[model samples]
Target: ADHRVSLPLAALLGAAFLPLADVAARVIDRPAETPVGILVAAAGSPFFILLARRIGRR
Candidate 1:
């Protein structure tokens, strides 16, 4: 629960997530590539909404 630990863990997870998303983008479209932002946003939006809602509740 410490910021020190959570920050680094978040960074590591983000680093890991981007590459996986990028790979998915490349593979998903075959001859073309999906924009990484689109993939990232699509994946992140729901989480962001949930986080916002949780914070709002607090």
Candidate 2:
């Protein structure tokens, strides 16, 4: 397995998620901010599971 593949994937996921977190923090709260890790995990877990399942199938 190319373990190095995960590094770029992780970076890309963070890059994609920060803006979403920032937007949610700005629009969904007036004086508070949501943690980006929560948003990332909420979205990433399902995706990671699906990807793992597909890879396992192969």
Models, CA RMSD each: 0.8, 3.1
Among the numbered candidates, top lDDT falls to 1
Task: Name the lDDT of candidate 2.
Answer: 0.80
Model 1, span 1-58: residue lDDT tens: 6999999999999999999999999999999999999999999999999999999998
Candidate 1 Cα errors over 4 Å, as ranges: none
Clashes of 2: 0
